[model samples]
Target: MSFYHNRLLEQDYYPVVRFYYYKEWEGFNMPNHSHEAIEIMYCLSGSCLIEVDGTTHKLKKGQFIFIDGDVPHRLFVEPGKSCRMSNIEFHFEELETVFPSFRHLVSEHEALRMLTESPKSYLLFHDSSDVFQCLNALILELDRKEDESVFTEQLLLGQLFIRMAELAAKQQNDTSEQHVYIQKSIEYMHQNYDRDIRVKDVADAVHLHPGYLHRIFKKAMGTSVNGYLINHRITKAKELLKRTNITITEIPHYIGMNSQQYFSTIFRQQTGSTPKQYRRESRYTDSRTVRSEHFKQQAK
Candidate 1:
C-alpha cells in the first residue's frame, strides 16, 4: 500500500472494508470529524496519536484503537517524524448477516457495550499478534487487486472479526498495568496541555519517576513526553488558527506557547505552514478581515 491509494469495497461487496497505508506521513492534520463507519486503526511502523472525543489514545507499533461509528476523532503525528499507520473502516451493518453473535456480544458485554453506546467510547489493545496478523493479511489481500476472491476475502474478514471479539472478551484480564500508567500520563497531558507543564509534571501526575516514565512513554507512545506535548499543543494551535479570528501572534498564547516565534517555527515544522498561512487559507474562514477585527476588538 502506497501513500495515497485506497482499497475500497465495491457497491456489491458483502462488506465494505477499506485498507489504507500511509508511509512516512508528515503530520496529516485531520480535524474533529466523524463518519457512519466503524474504524479500526493499527499502528504499523512509527507511532501515532489519535484523539477521540477529546481523549488522546497514543498507539505505538502493534496497537489498535477501535472507534465506533459516528464518533468524532482526529489523528496527530509528532513534528518532523514520519508516522505510518493502517486505517481500516468497515460498516457494522455489513456484518449483521454474517456475524450475528458478534453483534449480540457487543450488546451483552459491558466492555463492548460502552464501545457501541457511547460516542466517546473506544477499545484499545496492545501487542496482540493475532490481531496484527489478521490486519496484515487483509492489507496484503486487498493490495493484490487481481485476487478478487470473495470467498477468500470473506474468510479473512471472518477471522479478523473473530480475533477482535476474542480480544474484546478478554481485554479486561489482558490489559497491562504499565500501559495503564502510560494512558494516565497521556490523559494528564490532554487535560493540562494549556498549562506550563513539563515531562516531570506528567510523570509526577502519574506517580512514576521521570526517567522511568520517559522510557515507558516512548515505548508506549513512540515519542518523547515533550514531543507529544508539543504535538498536542500544535493540534490545538491548528484548531485555533482555523476556527477563530485570533491573530497569529495571539494564537500561540491561547494554546500555552508564550513565544509567537517558537510557536510559528514549531507549527510550520509540524503542519508545513505558519499560523498566518494556515489562517489565510482555511475553509473555516471565507473572509479574514472581518473576523480578525472582531476577534482583535473582542480581545481588547
Candidate 2:
C-alpha cells in the first residue's frame, strides 16, 4: 500500500478588533482624540458631522467614514437630532502566519491602497454595496465569542474590506462632468510628470480652457494644478529616494525639475529634509526593519 502525507500550516495572523458597537446618540459631541487602530463609522439613520484634521465632513444616512490610525477626529450630532451609527475600530497583528498582513493586502489592491494612503486623514463615501451588511455580520460574529466565530469574523471582515474598497472605487469614478475633468487632469499629470508640463497644457489635454479648468480643478481637488504638480513631483522624489539608489542630482531632472537647487528648496520646504538626508534616513530605517524581521524569524 502507498500513502501520501501532507502538512497543514497553522494560521497565526488575525485582525484585532478593539471595539465594535451599534449605538444611538442624541445631541452628542465627542472630543477630538486619536487612536492606534483604524476606525469605520457608518451612519445608519439621521446624520452627523465628523471633523477630521480640522476639516468638517457630514456623514448622512447610508454614508460612512474610514478614519486612518492616529488621526485626530471628533463626532457631533446637532442638539435635537438623533443619529444611529455602527462603529468598529481594529488593527492587524502579525505573528508567524500563512495569512498576509493588512499592508500586504493594501499593496495588492489598488483601490484599497488609494483609500489607505490618501493624503486626507479620513475618507467618506456612500455605501452602495454589502458594506453595511458585512459590517453588521462581523459585529454579530465577534459577539458570539465561539471558537468557530473567529474564522467567521475574519471572513466577514475581509468581505467588509472588499465592499468598502468597491465603494471607494465608485466614489472615485464619479460620472459628473467636473469630476471627470479633474480625474482626467490628475491622470494626465501622473502620466506626464517626467515632462515639463503646465496648467495650460493640462487644460488643453482635457479640452478645457485654462481659466475654466483652473476653477473646476481647484474646486474639486482643493489645490491649483501647479501646486498639485509640484507636490506630485516631490512625492515621486521621495519614493525614489526611499526605494531606489538613484543619485540625488539626477532625481530633480528625472522628476522634470531642471535645477537641483530648486528641487532641494522645494523638498526641504515640504519634508524638512534635504535629498541626501532623506535617503540616508530611509535606508537606515529600512535596514533596521530588515534586522528586526531577521531577529523575529530567528526567535521563531
Candidate 3:
C-alpha cells in the first residue's frame, strides 16, 4: 500500500510528510510524477496554470490546491510567470482524525465523491495574508529537523482542513437537480441559530415543509436541526464557563437556554458532570482539596 517509488527513495530522505517552498522559471512541465501522499500546494508568490485530467484552472497567490492520491496531474509556468509555493505532502491517514469520511478508500475513480470536488481541484479565493501566516508557521513546524511532538501542529492542520472545506462548499455551484434544495436549507439553519428560531422559519427559507426539513437536516448535518441547535448552545455555554467566572444561573440566560433546570439536565447528560462539579473540578488550589497526610515526598 506504500505510495513511494523505491527507485527514487533511500533511507536518508524518505518522508511520509514534508513541507517546503518551491519556485521555478516559466515553461516548467512536471511530466506526471507519481507519489503516494496527497499533495497540498499553496501558491505563495506569482501565478501558474495547471492541467488535471484535461480540465484547466488558474492558480494564483494564496490559493491551496489538492491533488488526490495517485491522480495524474501536471503544472505549467507560462512565459514570464514565476511560481513560489509552500507545499505539504502527507498521507491520508493523518487526515482521518479530522474527517471521518476518509476512513475507507473510495477508489481512485471515486475519490472526488468523498471530498466532493473534481479529481484535481483548487480551493481558490482563500487569498488572505493572515491565513497564509498560520499555514507558514505550520509548515515550519512540520519541517523542523529537531525531533519534537507534532500533536499540536497536526491539530492546527486539521483546523485548516475544515476551513478549506468551508471555502470550497461556498464556491462550488452544485447545479444538481436534487441537491439544490438541500443546500438552500443547510444555509438557512446555519445563519439563524442565535434567535428564537423555528423549524418552520428555516423550512420557509428553503421552500420546504417543516417535516421535510427535519428529515433532511438529520441526514445532512448528521443530526436533526433541533439536536444541532442544542449542541451549539451547549458549546457556547462551555466556552463561557472556561473563559469567565459566570454563575450557572447566568449561563442559561446568556446562551438562550429555556430554563436553568433544562440546562443542568442537558449539561449533565452531555458532559457527565453538573455545572458546579465541572467548575470545581476545573479549578486547582494546589492540593487544598487533596487531603492525604501521608506525603513525605511532597513539595519541600
Candidate 4:
C-alpha cells in the first residue's frame, strides 16, 4: 500500500503569474516543498499559520508572504476555524517582452540576493496603513474573478510586488555584506557542479587565494568548501537518480562525482539513503511531482 502524505497542490505550467484569493480555515497545514514558481500569499481577515523551510510565522489579517521558488514551505489551519488567504503563483522570466527586469535580475543573481537579504515576505498592514489598504483592495479584486482578462490581475499583482521591492531595498542593511565573497564563491560552486569546479576557480572569481577563500567560506557558510560542493553535486545527483530515467553509472561524472561509490558515500552522509535506496524510495517523486519542478537555475 502506498500512502501519499500532505503535499503541495501539484500542477504543470510555464513562466507566468496567476492569482488565487479566499479566506482560510483552521487546522489547515501545508506540507514542506520547493517549486519552480515563486509564491505569494495575502492574508485578508483571519489568523492562520505559515511555515517556510521549517521556520514558523504567525500570520494575521492584512499581511502577505513572499516565498522564493527554491524555498520549501508549508501552511497550517486550525480545525473548524475559518482561515483564508490569497495565493498568487508566478515564474521569474528573463524575456524583456514578458518581464522588463527579467534579464537584469537573472544576470545579476537578484533572486538569490533577495532570498538571502530581503525581508518583504510578510507585509503587515499596521506597519504601513496606505500600502496595507491597497493590498486589501488588490485582494478583493483577486477574489471577485470578474475580470475577463487573467493577465490583468497578474499585472496588478506585479505592481504590488514592485512596490514591495522598493521598500525592502531601502530598508535592507546587509550586515551579511561581510560574507559577500563567501556567497559569491558558493554560487560559483553550485553553477559548475557538473564539471571540475575547483576551489581555486571560485577563489579567483572572488579575488582571493584558494587557501584563504576555503577558510573564509567554511567559517561563513558552516561547511567546508569541498564538502559543500560535493554536497550540492550529490544532492542534485540524488534528485536525478529518482526523478529521471538516467542510469546511475552515468549520473556521477555528469555531476562532477568521479565514482558511484563516492557518490553513494556522500549521498549517505547528507541523506540517510544510499543511491540505490534513494532510487527505490523515490516512488514518492512520481511523474506528478516531477512535472512541477524544472531544472533549478545555476549561478552564472
Instruction: Show where candidate 1 strays beyond 4 Å.
Output: 1-14, 93-120, 145-149, 175-300
The candidate with the higher lDDT, 1 or 2, is 2
* Candidate 3 C-alpha error for residue 34, in Å: 2.8
Candidate with the greatest TM-score versus the true structure: 2
77 Cα displacement, candidate 3 (Å)? 0.9
**lDDT per residue as tens, model 2, 178-198:** 888999999999999988888
lDDT value, candidate 1, whole model: 0.72
Question: Candidate 1, residue 130: CA error in Å?
Answer: 1.0
Candidate 1 lDDT for residue 181: 86
Candidate 3 on 1-300: residue-level lDDT in tens? 132222212222212455355555466767756565667777877887777656777788777677765666678888766887777776633332332222222222232233443333333445445556666777777656465554556555645554555555455543243266766765665665555676678778778787877875686568876787678777777777766788889888877675899999999988999988776765653244453443643744
Give residue 31's lDDT in candidate 3 (0 to 100): 75
lDDT of 2 at 78: 99
Worst 10 residues of 4 by lDDT: 1-10
Ranking by lDDT: 2, 1, 4, 3
Task: Give Cα distance to truth, residue 169, candidate 2, Å.
Answer: 1.5
Candidate 2 segments exceeding 4 Å error? 1-14, 95-100, 114-119, 175-178, 181-300
Error of 3 at 38 (Å): 0.5
- Please, what are the lDDT tens digits per residue for candidate 4 over residues 98-209? 4334323323444333633433333322224444554566667666767455454545554565455554544343325537878888788878889876777778888888
- lDDT (10s digit) by residue, model 1, range 6-86: 221112224457545645567677678987777888888888788997789888888888877677899888787667777
> Where is the poorest 10-residue window by lDDT in model 2?
1-10
Question: Which pairs clash in model 3?
Answer: none
Clashes of 4: 17
